[model samples]
Target: MAKRIVLFMFMTFTSLVLSGCLVAESKYLKKAEEADALGREAATLQEMHRELSAENGTLKAQLSRVKEEAAVLAKEKEKLSADNRELDQVLRSKTDSLSQTVADLRQKVSDLEDENARLKEEIAAAQKAREENVRQVSKTYEDLLDSMKGEIAQGQVTISELKGKLTVNMVDAILFDSGEAEVKQGGMDVLAKMVDILKGVQDKMIRIEGHTDNVRIIGNLARRFPTNWELSAARAINVARYLQSRGIDPAVLAAVANSEYRPVATNDTGEGRAKNRRIEIVLVPRDAP
Candidate 1:
């Protein structure tokens, strides 16, 4: 359009110049310059519009990609929420189990404490009973020792107390004849004194242990007592029977024989043989079974 306007103006100026109607050259040149300037401005406006349209297309593409990335991020967030919920359920289950286990451990600890207390009480009771038993045995030992001081001084008897057991040793000559198992009058009197001292004994067993010297049975005596074992056994039994008859508790009585064994002295000499042929009265704890 600007070119057409410039062409029409040029023709009009030529017609005027040919008819002798002259126009100013400055005005005509100024109109041509103004037309060229308008054309240049129009071209610049169209180029700017094209560049703007391309930039708008690029911005639209970028917006579409940004929206797609936002959708993917939303899906990931939903999946993460589901996974977190599952983890929470598992954690709660484990926590509940741990709580119950801790409670059971606490209960077991309380039960053990109760059991420990019960054991302590039982041990205390047992200790008290043991102390009472010791006192009872000590009194019995002192009383027997005082009452038999004369026999103890003459070496006819020896009294000993060891590890809660009390023992009284008497020679065979004081309790029996040369080859007899019978208790004589003097022996009965000595046993009567022992029975009096031992009457108040509690929770104890009184055992009569008879020992014989290392002498073989021979002559007429061999017929009835074939060996020292038989003779010693018979003598122990007789002494136990006599003590039972003298107000001692028969339930606490036991008889044992040591024939030429468990001797306190050797049987080679006459004095040692006399010491070996002795009876022992022992106070001991009762067997359970």
Candidate 2:
């Protein structure tokens, strides 16, 4: 446009010069120069406008790309926020479960400790009671041993103590004669001394056990006694009856018969057979069944 305006102005000035208009030539030349200057200024302004338009277009494109990148960054930020919230919830639930488990374990450990303490106390009390019982039993054994020293020396009686019980073993010959179950005079004398000692015992049950040799019964003895079982039972009953008549408590007495099965020695020799035929008097706790 500036070039076209400049060309039209130059053609008008050339026509004026050809028509011989010398008075207007100076004015036309000045107008022509002014028009040329205006044309050059317009061309410069147009070039600046073109450059400004190009720069504006580039800026618009750069702004559009920046907007797209901002949208992507916003979406990523939202996603990361949601993920963080989920992670926090999971961590809280796990912590709560773990705390409950730890509390339950601590309660169980406390209950076990209480049970262990109770058991320890019971064990200590029982140990103390047993010690007292042992001391009492030892004293009783010493007294009986001293009282029966003479009979023990003559081999007519044997005394022993075990656990919390006292035992007095007597040969059957001194109490009976040739399968007889009745107590002899000498046996009564011996029993009188033992009964005196046993009567003083408290909380003790006196048990009389009758034992016999392995000899089988025959002839006159068989007719009266039958087997050793009946003989031993009869002997034990007679002894218990005798003790009851001599101031010993009938309620505390128990008579048991052993028919050669519970022998102290082998029954193959005379001395062994003699030893096998005996009576055992045991004193035990009244509560023992």
Find the candidate with the highest lDDT and give its number.
1
TM values, all candidates: 0.68, 0.62
Could you give me the TM-score of model 1 versus the true structure? Answer: 0.68
Candidate 2 lDDT by residue in tens digits, 142-180? 777777778888898898888888888999987888779
- For residue 6, what is the lDDT in candidate 1? 92
For each of the candidates, the C-alpha root-mean-square deviation to the true structure, in angstroms, is 8.2, 9.6
The true-structure Cα RMSD of candidate 1 reads 8.2
Could you give candidate 1's per-residue lDDT for residues 1-289 as a string of tens digits?
9999999999988887865634566677889999999999999999999999999999999999999999999999999999999999999999999999999999999999999999999999978978888888898888998998988889899999887889999999988989999999999988988888777888889999989999899999999899999999999999999998888889999999889988889889999899999999999988622
Model 2 clash pairs are none
TM-score of 2: 0.62
